[model samples]
Target: MNNIKIKKNFSPKTYLHKYVYDDIRPIIKKKRKKVKSCDFKIVEPENYKNIVCINYNVNQLKQMCKRYKLKVSGNKSELMYRIYNFLKYSYYCIKIQKNYRGYLYRQYEKFKGPGYKNTKLCCNKTDFLLFEEIKNLPKKQLFTYKDKDGFIYGFDICSLWNLIYLNKETKNPYNRNQFPEDMLYKIKRIVHIGNIYNYDINIEVDKSDLDILSNKKKIELKTLEIFQKIDKFGHITNISWFLNLSKIKLFSFLRELIDIWNYRAQITMETKKNIFPPSGSPFNNINFMILRHKKIEYIQEKMLRLINRLITYGKNEEYCKLGALYILGALTMVNNNAANALPWLYDSFMIVS
Candidate 1:
């Protein structure tokens, strides 16, 4: 048996080359993040180092030629290069020629999808025309340009979303456990409480009135007064006014006031948490830090002090008004200077008479 002699040749240069290639290849490796559910396949170039030609889906190539202000027929390679350059320069991320082809394919796919995403109409159309007009217009005509009056004319779309989004506050009335009468009384208490602070607002209920006409007329008059106040001064203001008055005649105003206060309180809470869109000004790139625990602790201390004062001299005419004022003031501070605060304070002071 003749044994075949085999030579195992391992060289230092071969090992060194392997290591160098491994280290350097990573620098030139594909960088694009893998896009999910992309319609186009990435086809790599065989001859050129980093170039690729993309075969279009249907009339996509024709569309591309049209897009770059070119005729749809002939000079295919030049049109392809134009498309490549457009993507590379415009997006700034599509550096490789293959990346440009893949992007165009993806955009074409998206344009043809059920809901066209990121696809702009041609410059001739109404939407695009209007956009161009706005873009070229002087800064004075624009809504929120820095050179303009700094007033944004449009609604905060997010705010409108929140305002109309949900009806979470409407409690279920059909539940056997939920007593409508009890809820009604609680609402009535809130009304009474408000009226005690604002004596002038209360409806006049004469003890001498036994006639049905007089009683009916008194109720009607009181209802009109409350409605008028609500129309003039908003819910929170009316509630504060009611709370400040003496409980003279609050028939239906009390219910409306309670509902309004509850709504406002919820709104204030939402605003503080940034759950609701801002009602004031446009958001700017401003930075500020607030220590939440520190603020809450400080406010809690003030609230406790006010509660103690209210408990101590709530009955005495002189101190009663003062205590009410203090409580309202503290609540106002806790609510972050909400607009309703002043009304509450004013109503409390009105009952000093």
Candidate 2:
């Protein structure tokens, strides 16, 4: 297999150009915008005006292709040929083959199109995994910065490390910045979490989050401690992580994420209008607390009604499962209805198909 080298020193403008040409141009085309361009803003994930992608890291993508006897020969013709061969070889179902063929063509087109500016897409989860892998790998020969955590940071830890490496060897760093949108989404999620869990993990000045990541020994120990605490609580084990959690099984994770956010944002997640007392506040007013709790109850009930309607007569199974889970989630948070939601949530889990 041919391998691409990753360069250490790249002009920031040139670096940005590579990404626009290599990644963005193929998917989106726009009038060439200046460096301080206002052409592309990262698209919000909630907006469904464009394509939706399921992601696994580049390594995983390669592995899957290999498993199916497919190859990603750098050239588009080769890639198309391989995709066509795979379509013919794997499935007799005409519909499935057509879908695969169509998907491949669109992906290929996006990979090869002219760069657009000012628009962002949904983050690709696979890209985050790939970025993590690149960050862990040895630094390429270049200027390296050490943080307060005593870990080195360098350009080797890019979101599109593979593309960078390929660009270096080919002397064509065109697709360098076409970071999968899902990776950006993860950053958003993490930032949101950080904003909420801001007090939980302190970033030492001169020590970035990447620094905390560098020491495997310390990270492992801390992770183990968190797992132990979760084990003791049992409640957290029931909570799902949004990224890793299945779409149908997202309610609990969404609920927890929102709750955590609420706690961080100093408000109730369900009743968005309500605010909680600041942490460690000396003021403990019972009447106010009662009123807030009642308001939350009302909101939860409203969500419950919506959820129940979607689940019982939902047109799609996935939507039904989502609704059921959310309904159960609403009940779980309230003081009284938590018990009632359990069996329903459990039943919904069984029906997920």
Q: Count the backbone clashes (under 3 Å) in each candidate.
A: 13, 26
TM-score of each: 0.17, 0.17
The positional error of residue 120 in candidate 1, measured at the CA in angstroms, is: 40
Q: Write the per-residue lDDT of candidate 1 for residues 48-95, one digit (tens) a residue.
A: 222123244324545655655545665544444434444434343334
User: Model 1 segments beyond 4 Å from truth?
Assistant: 1-63, 67-77, 89-353
**Prediction 2 TM-score vs. true:** 0.17
- Count steric clashes of candidate 2: 26
* TM-score between model 1 and native: 0.17
Instruction: Tell me, by lDDT, which candidate is best.
Output: 2
